[model samples]
Structure formats: structure tokens, C-alpha cells
Target: MVRRGVLGYVLVLVGGLVVSVLPASSAVASLPLVADLRSSTGGRMLGLAVVVVGLGLASSAWLRLVRAAGDLGVREDDRTALVHRATAAWTLPLLLAPPLFSRDGWSYAAQGVLTHLGLSPYVWTPSILDGQVVEAVDPMWLATATPYGPLPLVWGSAAAGLTTDPWLLVVAHRLLALVGLALLAWAVPRLSRWSRVDPARASALVLASPLVLAHGVGGVHNDLLMAGLAAVALVVAARHGWLVGALVVGLGVAVKLPAGVAGVGVVLVTLPAAARVSARATRATQVGAVSLLTVVCIGAVSHLGVGWVHALGVPGEVQTPLSVSTQLGRLAHLLTGADLVDAFRTAGSVLLVVVAVTVGLRSRSGDRRTALRATAAVALALVVLSPVVHHWYVLWCLPFLAAVELPARGWQALLHASWLGGLVAPLDSSLRGADAVIAVGVAVVAATALVQAVGHRRAEIRAEVRAGAQARTGDASPTSPISR
Candidate 1:
């Protein structure tokens, strides 16, 4: 197991090193050697090849780590410790590497600088800033105001104060993401125990997932922080009470609004198992009040007002294929030659609210496990039905889902999703304008790796099923000579 982890770590590190050389829109211009390499087509192709191979290797390694985590002979505490150590080791390579998979880190740095200059990120675009910071920002977001809450702005402002270098500032943001990762490490196991799932298995699923590593950590996304805090909130609420949970989730909301959904779980878990409708409503109201109060206090303290609430629609401006509503809208437009994107998006939003309310109402009288599942369901609904869906958005519910027991097929689906999500950015980044031969080769390799991984998991599942059936038959057989 240790050897497998070491191998995985080495593969990811090698891939990360190659990725570090690829010219990102937000990359710092200080590395002359890397710059020279990136300026040449051959160098770029070599880097792409290395990156593709690295991703395949890393994906395989992650699969092995997850599989090893499920060994029943391993004690739960030992499994948890193994996952934690492996996660820490795996994170080391990407810790200092340039932001992987996305340019949002650049935006965070620029926004932080804006905040430090007493400019409101909620109102001011990163374009307002001058120098390397603004240069590193993606053009699409250059003029777009950030819809993120004030807490992140404040966090960014603190990092900006420490370093004027854009790369360093982005690294600072990565450190913030690390804090979130720490919270997940601490919270996932407790939540898993509450749900009667294996702590190590759940920890491996969330903390060591390729999706979390590539996007949550490598991308330096604030979603990591939000998800971590939300997970902690659910666990805290389940153990301590709803008030503490409300406060924790409120802090999460201040990082990203979607995290506010966890507040429902907090409320539901605190209600009596046979609570009346009025009682449920009252508890929800109380939790909502505390959460709202927390957000209001954060905004006031940060001096960045709650204007972000109005700008929540900012992300919807971009269309992503992952968004069910966006694709449906596009399909409608294609068929009817009419623009119905907004209508579809509005309908999706309405449906999400209805689902959240229905789930909350039905789960309010259930156990903590049910509340946790309900929260996960609402989060999944939010991502699926939102106007814009980024791959990392799934992180919002990943911890909760990991804490719950899932069937073999469900785990298989998650594994596939994680593998694909981890590959999306590297493939997209490396293949654009690349030599056709190289692109095709890389795609074939990735597809083959995925197929093999899936096939291996299916085989393992079949073996486990057969073993279970044999064990059941053995238990049912008589030990008497007559029966023999």
C-alpha cells in the first residue's frame, strides 16, 4: 500500500512539473527558461506529451489508493490515517506548482489587490488593477465583477498585503485552499461515522479524490474552502447543536453562497424525530436567522456590504455544457430558433428551490444520516440545475455524498466522474493547436487508461459479490453428518 502511494505521488509530481511549464494565461512571466521552452512548438508538444502521460499515471494511482482504502482487514483508524498521509503526500507536488486547470487563481490575486487598494471586488473588475496582476487575469473575466462573497475578498486582501507578486499571491490563495482541505480532513470522518459509513473509505473518496486534487487544490478555487466549511458545519451541527452549525455554515456562505444549503441539514438534524410541521418550520426559521445574522455580520466587519447577493447572477452569464439548464436552453434555441435560455434557467432555479424545500420537509423528522443525504441531494440539484456549472461545483456535495453509503454502481459512477473531471483541463489545455498526431495519441492513451480502470473496478465488484454469495451459502449449510 505504501509503495503504491509512493508511486502515485511520484507520477502526480512528474505530471505537475510538466504542467508547471505549460504557458497558462495567468502564469507568471519570470521563468525565462520555461518561457523560452514554451515559445517553441516542439517544446510545447513535449510538455503536452508529458502532461498526458502524467495524468494517466496519476489517475491509475488514485484508483489504487482508493481500492486499497477499502481493505476490510485494515482497521478503520488505520485506513483513515493512511488516506490522510497519502493525501498530504500527494498534495505536496501541486502545492508549489502554478495553478493547474484554471485561471481563477489569477482573478483571486487581482481581486485581492483590488480589495487591498480599498476597491470593492464585488463592484470593481480585476481590469481596474494595473501591472502583472491584471495581465495574468483571463480576458473573459477582466471586465466582469466578482460575485464571490466579501470573506474571500478579505482573505485575498490579506494575501495581497503579504506579496505584490501575482504568482505569490496566487500561491497564497492556494494556502487558503489548503486550510479548506484541512477542514475536510477533520470533518469527513466524523460525518461518515454519523452516517454509518467507513471513515477511511469516505475520507479517501473526498480528501484523496482526483477531482479535489486537480480542481479544488490545483485550481486554487474558493469552492474548496466553501465545501470544507460546509462539511465542518454539518458535522458540528450534528454533534454540538444547530446554533454552532448555523454559524459555521454562515461562514461558508460568506465564502460562496451555495454553501448556505448546508444550513438546511443543520436545521433538519436538530429537529425532533417526530416533530410537527409547525415545529420544523420554527426550527428552520431559527437556524435561518442565525445564518443570515452571521453573513450580515461578516459583510459589516469586512466592510464590503452584501452587494454580492445581487451579482449572484454574474456566473450565469457564461454557458457551460455541464449545466443541464444551459444545454436544454441551447437545445430549445436550436429547435425553435427562439432564445429561451433565460426561461429555462429561471425554471431550473424554481425547481431547485422546490426540491430543497420538499427534501427538507420530508427529512426534517429523520436521523442525521437522512438530513446529510438531503443536503447532498439539494447540492447536487443546485449544480445540475444551475445556469452555469463548473466541474469543481460538484465539490459542494462530494463530502456529504462520501459520508453516506453508496452501492457499487454509484461508487463506479463517482470514480468515472472524478477521472474525467481531472482530465478535462489538461486535455483542453494541451490539445489546442497541437500537432494532430500528438493530440490523437494523447486522447487514445487517456481513453485506454479510463477503460482499463473501469474494467478493473467492475471485475473487483464481481469478485466481491461472488465471495459474498459463497459466504452466505456456507453460513446457511448444516454441520451435521446427515446434512453433509
Candidate 2:
């Protein structure tokens, strides 16, 4: 474990140094600080190489951490501590770097600029900003209003803070994201214990995930913040009262709209059985009222108004790859030679609702484990079906999914596949030509890895079952230690 920690930290530190010194997006490069490095194509290529290498190292380190976590004999608290230490070692350097791999960080700063100007982010684009902030934001988003929730926008407003420097604002926003990581670090282990998962294993799965650290913290996306808060809400729901948990979940949704979906599982868990139809309905109504009211009250306090709802459908306007809706749209066109993009999108939405309802109903078993699994199922269904899917969005489903124990190799398979897929795929564009080829290559590798891992796990389970059966049979035999 110590060796793995040291290796992971070294690789992460090197990666951070490389990314920090390298030129970033064009908008960031336009700044005087990195003007010289910006012009060097070779330098940028070298930096990219370093970043990829770093990711590989981090991925390896995670495997080692998983191995450490597999020692069930270890104290749960001690394992949690190790996971936390590993997270800090791996995350801090990436945080210090200038938004390692995505231009979205620049967009975040620009959105903050818009908020600072008292413009409703839902109605106006960053193009309204007439300075470096304009250049910092991607043109794709220039004509489109922000789809971010009000809480993140409000944070952006504070981050903007009279600084015309886009870099400063980007750093400020990243710092805010750091707070969210801290929240996750604190909440995940507790949530794991409450959910009856091995706290150490759960912590390792979440904290050491490349998707969480690389795309989440490194890109400085607000989704991590939302996820952190949502984790807290889940923990509260399990250990404390439902009303307070409802409020916390609402706060998470205020950061990003999807966080509210998790509340469905929370509410379902509180409802009585279907036999008590009227009582169940009453409980449902109360939960809905409190949850929605909490969200509205939080929005009101943020002063962003409810206009943000107008942007809720904005993400659908952009078609991202690897999403169920996007692929379905393509399939429809291929089958009928007609554009059924909108129809397919609507279908995906309907499918997601169906899946969420099914999972929520399943959660009515009233077990915290069932509720968490339900929450994960709903989140996974939503991400798979959503019109827009950033690779980082996978992180949304990870915490709860991790809480449900699977065999170590099964979890490893998922971790490797998700990490590889997330690393290769871009959120904004469909994979095509060479990019598609490369993504396919990565998928093939990940699939192969999964098969191998799954095989090993199956063997282990078989062995365990055989051993248990033998022990039972031996115990039943009267001659076996006098039936002791």
C-alpha cells in the first residue's frame, strides 16, 4: 500500500508539473504568461504525452489501492484513512495545474463573468462579455445560454470578483471544486458504513477513480461539487432525518439539475407499502412537496430566479456521443433514411422515466442498501439516456454503485472500463475516423481486461462456494468432531 501510494503520488506530481507548464486552450494561451509555450507545437505534444502517461500511472496506482482495500481483515476506519491519503496525494497536484485537459474550465470562468455582470446565465451567453472572458469561452456555447444550475452560477459570480483575468477566475472556481472533493472525502466512508458496504473499499472506488480525479477535479467541473453534496445527502438520509436529507439533496440539485433525481430514491425509501395506498400517497406527496419546496427556496436565496429552468432543456440541443439518445438518433436515421433525432430523444427521455420509476419502486423494500442501489440504478439510467454526456458524468453513478459490494475483480473490471472509456471519449463531439478508431482500440483493450478480471472473480466465487458447502457437509456429519 505504501509503495502504491508513493508511485501514484510521483506520477500525479509529474503529470501536474507537465500540465502546469504546458500551454492550455487558445483562450488561455492568449495570455502573456504562456505566450511563448503556446507557439511551440512540440511543447504541446510533449505535454499531452505527459498527461496521458500520468493518467496511466494514476490508473496503475488505483489498482494497487484496490488490492490494499481487498484485505477485509483491515479495520474499516484505517482503510478509509489510506484512501483519503491516496486521494490527496493524487488530487492536489492536478488541482494546482491549469485545468489539465478541458476548455470547459475557461467557459466556467466566462459564465462567472456573466453572473458578475448581473446577467441571467440562463438567458445570455458569455459573448456579452467584451474582453478576454469572451475568448476564453468556446464558440459552441457563445450562442447558447448556460445549462448549469443556479448554485454553481452563484459560486461563479463570487469567483468573478472584479477580476478580468480569466485564469484567476478559473483557479477560483477550481478551488470551489476542491471544497466539494473535501466533502466527498468526508461523506463517502460514512455513507459506505451506513449502507453496509466496506467503508475502505467504497472510499477507494470513489476517490481513486480516474474519472473522478482526472475529469472531475482536473477539469474543475461543477458536477463533482453536485456529486459531493448528493453523497452528503445520502449519508444524512441513512443516519439522520429524511427532511434534512431532502434539503441537502435540493442544495445539490441547485448545483446541477441531475442531483435532484437521486431524491426520488430517497423519497421512495420513506414511503409505506403499496397495501397502504392512501398512506403511501400521503407520504409521497409530503416528500415531493418538501423536496420541491427546498429546491425553490434555495433558488430564491441564490437570487438567480427560476429562469434557470429555461435552460434545463438546453443540453438536449447538443448531441453528445456514447449517450443512448445520440446513438438511437443515429440508428433511426440509418434504418429509415429520415431524421428522427427529436423523436429518438423523446424516446430516451421516456425510457429514462420508466427505468427510474421501476428502480424507485424496487427501493420500496425499505432497506438502505436497496435504496442506494436504486439511486445508482436511476443515476446510471439517466446518464446513459441523457442527450448530453460528459465523460465526467459517469462519476455521478459511481458512489452509490460502489456502495453495493461486488466481487473485487468485478469492481476492478468496471473501474478499468470506465476509466478507459472516460479517458478516450470527449463530451462535445462524436468519435469519428481516427478518433473513433482510437476509441475502439481502447474499448477492445478494456473489454479484454474485463473478461480476464471477470473470469478470475468467477473462479474465486466458485472456490468460496465449494469451501462453504464442504464446511456445511462436514459439520452435518456426526463423525466430524462429534457434530461440533
Candidate 3:
């Protein structure tokens, strides 16, 4: 057991080191070393291969660590602590690594520079800036307005106050992301217990997840901060009262609009199990009022106003396969030979609203478990039906889902998806032409092997459960030594 833990830690650490050497999308072109590597076809190909391999190693290590935490011999508290320790140790290598899967970290820094210049990010694009900071932003987004909430801009502005160097700015963004990871570590166990799920398993599922490591930490996405705040809000609401939860979730919403879904959850969980429909309605109203007021206050203090709400459509400008709506639109266009992408996307938005409303209404019975599950469902719906989707968007629903008890197959699917999400980072990066093809091929092979391994593990788990049951039955027999 000790050996396996050590091996997993070492594997992930080494993987992080290998991946960190590759040039990031936002790497300064003037850097002699980076320019030399980028100019070489052979170097690019080799770097791509190394990144794929590194991601695989890290993902495999994460799987091993998660499984080890599930050892029946370990106490729940010990298991939770072990996962936490593993997460902290594994994060060390990537803590200062270049942005692994996405260039959003650089964009964040650029936005902060904009904020510091007294320009509203929602009103101005990074293109307005001059110097290294603007150069670090993705060209595609250079002229596009930011879709993120005002609170994130404020956070970025704070980081900008420290330095204007793009690299240091990215590192600062990463450090801020760590604050969110810490919040998740603190909240997941409590939420798991509330939902009657195993705290250790939940911790491993959310904290040690490759998705969290590769994107939440490595990519420096604001989704991590939003998720942590939402989780803490739910826990606080359940403990203190719905009012506090509203305040906390409002902060989350100020980070990202999708987090407002948790506000509904806070209201549901705070209601009495046998509360009347009228009571549910009244509770929802109060929570909604408090949450709205909090968000307004945050916007006012940030001085960015609410222009971000209008700019939420910014992400839809770029179409990616990750979006279910986009796929559906493509399928429709192919079938009818008509440009139905926009129409289909609009329908998806409407459908999302319907599904969220249905889930929220059904959880009015006030069962905390059901309320939590409902919140997860709403978050899932938001991602699936949105006009645009990013790999890290899964963070929105992950914490809530991790807290809920799932079937064996459900857990297996979620685990595999999380690992695969991290492993697919290369494809999401700036790799083009041959490098992209190689990434796709490697991802396919890795995904297949992962599925097979999980299937085998599932069989072993079933066998163990059967054996344990039989042993207990034998011990209960009249002629057995213990029975005698």
C-alpha cells in the first residue's frame, strides 16, 4: 500500500515536470528559447508526444491514489486525510508550471491589466492594451470582451497590482486559483457527510481528480473559484441558515453566473422536510431577494457595473465540439443542408431554463439529499444545453455531484470522464495540423485502455464484496467457531 502511494506520487510529479517544459499558448514570442523550440517542427512533435505521455502518467497516478483511498482497512477520516495529502503533494510540481491545458490564465492577467488601467474589462478588450500583457492574450480573444463576472476582474486587478510581467501575472493567477482548491478541500468532506456519501471517496473524486489538477489548477480557470464558493455556500446554508448561504452563493454568482444555481439549492435544503408548497415558495423568494441584493452590492463595489451580463454571449462566438448544442446544430445542418446552428443553439437555451425549473420545483420537498442532487442536475443541464462549453466547465457540477451517493456504474463513469478530461488537454491546446492529429490518436488509445482497466477493477470490486458477504454468513452459521 505504501509503495503504491509513493509510486503514484512520483509518477504524477514527474509527469508535471515533463509537461511544464512545453511552450504555452501565451508564451512570449521574443523569448529566445521559446522561439527556437516553436520554430522547430521536430521539437513541436516531440513536445506534443511528451505532453500526451505526461498527462497519461498523471491520470494513471490519480486513479491509483483514488483506489488506494478506498481500501477497506482504512478508516474514513484516515482515507480523507490521505487523499488530501496526496492532492497537496501531487499539486507541487504543477503549482508553478506554465498553463497546462488552456491560455485563459494569460487572458486573465491581461484583463487584470485592463482593470488596473481604469478600463472595464467588460467594456474593453485586451487589444486596447500595449506591451507584453496584451501579447500574452490569445489572438482570437484579443478583441473580444470578457464574459467573466466583476469579482474575477477584481481578483485579477489585485494580481495585476503586484506585477505586469505576463509570466509573473500568470503565476499570480495560479496562486489565486490555489485559494479555491483550498476551499474545495475544506468543504467537500462536510457536504459529503450531509449527503450520506463517503467523505474520503468524495474528497478523492473532487480533490484528486485530474480535471481539478489539469484545469482548475494548471489552466487557472475561474470556474474553480466559483465551484469552491458554491460548495461552501451550500454547507453554510445547511448549518447556519439559508440567509448566509444566499450571501455566500451570491459571491459565487459574482464570480460566474452559473453558480446562481446553488442559490436555489440553499433554499431547498433549508426548508423543512415536510414544509408546505407555500412555505417553499416563500423561502425561495427570500433567498432570491438576498442573493440578488448581494450580487448588486458586489457589482457596485467592483465598479464594473453589470455589463458582464450582456457580454455573456462572448463565448458563443467560437464553436467547439465540447458544446452539445453546437453538435446538435451541426447534425441538423448536415441533415437539412440549412444553417440551423444559431436556431438550435437558441432552442438549447430555452431547454436549459425548462430543465432547471423542473429540477428546482421537484426538490421542493426539502430533503437535503434531494436538494443537493437537484442542484447537481441543474448544473449539468446548464453545461449540456449551453451554447458553448469548455472542459473545465465540469467544475460547476462536480462538487455537488461528488457529495451525492451514486451507483457503482455512475461513479465509474464520472471517474473515467474526469481522467479523460485531463488527458485530452493537448487537443484543447494551440497544437495544429499534425500535432492535433497525433493528440487525437493518442487520446483514443488512452481512453480505450482506461475503460478496460476500470471494467476489470469493477469486477474485482464485485468479487471482494461477494467474498466479504459470504465470510459474514459463514461466521453467523451455528457450527462456525465464532457462533459456537
Candidate 4:
């Protein structure tokens, strides 16, 4: 128990809970303890204190849970799966409440609902008529008012059209996101099964992860639709079929261009595995079927034309700490007069390209052995290294990490904490003051993940060494590295 990471997780969570439970209303005495960002002279300090404590608690709880996952180990499949389940499960309550500072979720819902009404959402600002209730979309989104993409608009419209109330629209969108999650839970395992991976563990990692709960359910970002589609596409491709694979992957790209990272992995799988003409043809057949499926479904749903293309006109979000806007802010502060916002957008775009190339190179071997891992790294790296990274963006990486075979306790602990920090960045004023927290936290978790992956390589090498020695000596009494 002492060696396991659970003890740390439990302690931190309890400490955070204690802090959170404090009566923050008595700011006359507690003002001194308020975070710097919340250190405003006004009575807002009391509310700020509460938000800070809550964010801290959430961050601690998330990290501890990740550590718990590491403690469970690979061989303990059921137990390990349970850990991911525990983390994934919390998403239920958090999402039921208000949109937890996830402005993106709100905008997505707003756009979808508007589209469903046959209104040009991008052109019709949520700021129109009522207050800026749909605050997530571009200020110019309504002005640009062009149709973005067919799929997202259809989804957004349906979700939004469910109710006239902004709040209700958010709820319906989350429900739709939940449906996407069901597809993910079903699809990832099936993909693993067909690919001969650790089907139980792989499925567990994805289906039960804390990150998924936080973002998919908590943030309720529409990226889940993209990820779920991507996973199904992989399953199709890995089964040695390509047409359906292309269509699904294409749909993923339609939802979010970054979702296209999976296509790189698919391309890798297609090359050697389909090296033979017959295999290549079979793969082509699958791709064609998938293409047809996507085309027909999207066509039936909406008019796939200029209106849909216009939906993507709103390129970057500038309000939150997580986007290219953040970098732009810093650079503008440095460079005499150039806009940091412009800098950030440029930097983020370049980053996406780099991550794509890197993922492509790593996955070129065309084996499922590293396919998911490489794809995830590519996806995550794109977000992490970008000028702006959002909490929901983490959803893009969780599935790959879930399916990864190795788990390092220390690194997992870091990821757990960082995931929580992502949640905190929006609500806590302290985070704004101590903005450094997010940057440091993200670096820590990313480093942790890298360490865990590398550590596995070292462990494997040692195991091989021990096995070779045993073979030489023909010893039966010594222990095996993996048997425990």
C-alpha cells in the first residue's frame, strides 16, 4: 500500500476536500489566504477563494486517480480496468451541472441548434436578440454566418433545436456527446480485438479513463464524435478493409480537422499489411465502402456545399488561456507592437503541421504494435505544443493512452493532476493570477507520460537480459520479471 500511488492520491484528495469545505464567505479573516488572482479589494474575494479551493481539490483528485491506475498494473486486467472506470465514472455528476466553464461546449451547442433551425449559425451571432448566451462561438461567427461543415452543423443544429433555452441546448449537446461515448466504448475494444491487442485492458483504459470523464462528459466537447468516428475507422482499416475506413476517417476530419491524425495511422497500416495486390485490393474495397457510407449519410443529412464550408470560417478561439491567443498575448507583450493574437494563430498552425509529420514518420512501420500510441502522441503533441491547448482537447489523446500497454506510476500521477488542472483553468481566478500553474502542470504530465513510455522500454530490456541469463544457467528457482 505504501509503495502504491493510491496513498498519495488519497492524501491529496482529502487535503483538497478539507480546503474546499472551508466557509469561504468569511473573507474578512480569510482574505489574507485568498489567491493572488482573487486578491481583488472587492467582496469577490470570498467567491474567488471557493473557486480556488475547488480547483485545487479537483486537480489533486484527478492525479491521485491516475496514480491508482498505475498501481493496478497490466496483468491485473480487471482491477486496472476498475481504476479507469472509477475515474471515467465521475463525469456523470460534473456534466449534469452547468457547463463547467467549457465555453466551447456552449458555442458548439448553439451553432448546432441554430443550424438545425435552418439558420446560418455562423452568420447569426448568439449575441443577437438576447444576451451573449452562446458565448463560445466567434464574435464574428454570426456575421460570417456561413455553413461550416455538414456533420457538425447538423449535430449542432439538432442539439440546439432540442430546446429554445441556451441552458437546455448545452444539456442536449452533452447528451449527444454521451451517445458518442457509447460508440467509443464499443468501438475501441472491438478494434483492439480484431488487431489482437490486449482487448480487455485496451478497452478498459479508454472506456474508464478520468480524462474521458472530465472532457467527454464534463466538458462535453464535440470532439468525442470525431474520436469515436476515428476509432471505428481504425477498426475497419485494421480488419483489412479501406473504403469504409476512408469514409469514417473522413467524417472524423469533418467534425474536427485534427481528428485527421488517425488517418496517418491508417495510412501506415495500409501499406505493408496490404503489401500484396490482393490485400491492397481488399483494403481498397473497405476504403470505398467507408467512403460511400460517409457520403450517403452526410448527403442525406444536409446540403454539402458552400454553406457547410463556411462553418469553418471561425478558425481560432481567443478568449481562453488554452488557445493560440495565449501565445499571442505574450508575444505582443514582447515585440514592440505586433499583435500577439496573430502570432499565436500562426504558431499554432505551424505546430499542427509539425505534429502531423512526426506522427506520420513514427507510424510508417505499418503495425498496430505502435499504431495507437503513435497516433495519440501525434494528436496530443499537436495540442500540447500548440500555442493554445484546451481542457477538452485532452479528449483527443485519452483513447490512445488508454490502449497503451505500459503504465508508469509516477508519470500516471502527473497526468492525473494535469487533467484536473485543465478543468480548473477556466473557473479559478487564481489560475489567471498564477497562470504559470497550467503551463507547468501540462509539462509535468507530458513529461510523466514520456517517462512512463520510456521506462517500459528499460524494463523490457532488463527482462530480456534476465531471461537470457536464465536460459544459459537453466535455473528454475529464480523469479521471472513479469510473473510476480
Best by TM-score: 1
Per-residue lDDT of candidate 3, residues 1-484 (tens digit): 3333344434433433333333244445435764565566655555555555656566666776676566545677787888888888777766666666667887888899899888999889998888767654678888988888888788788878888877787778777778889899999888888777778878888997878887998788999989999999988998899999999988888888888888778878898887776887788789888987888888888888888888888888888888988998999999999998999899999999888767766665557788788888888888888888989999998988888877777777777778778777666645545554455547654775576467547745664665567678874212211010
Best-fitting candidate, scored by lDDT: 1
lDDT (CA) per prediction: 0.77, 0.66, 0.75, 0.53
Residue 400 shift from truth in candidate 4, angstroms: 1.7
Error of 3 at 475 (Å): 8.7
lDDT of 4 at 389: 69
Worst 10 residues of 3 by lDDT: 475-484
- Estimated TM-score for each candidate: 0.90, 0.82, 0.88, 0.65
State the weakest 10-residue window (summed lDDT) of model 2: 475-484
Per residue, candidate 4 scores C-alpha lDDT tens digits across 91-159 of: 444444434434455566666665666666545655553443444343444344543345666766666
Error of 2 at 162 (Å): 5.6
lDDT of 1: 0.77
| Alpha-carbon shift of residue 33 in model 1 (angstroms) | 4.3
Off by over 4 Å in 4: 1-77, 80-89, 129-148, 159-162, 187-211, 273-300, 304-308, 311-313, 317-362, 385-387, 405-420, 427-484
For candidate 2, list the clashing residue pairs, or say none: none
lDDT string, candidate 1, 334-445, tens digits: 9999999999999999999999888887774648888888888898898889889888998988888888777767766776787667755565432335566356546755
> What's the distance in Å from true for residue 363, model 4?
3.9
Please give the TM-score that candidate 2 achieves against the real structure.
0.82
Ranking by lDDT: 1, 3, 2, 4
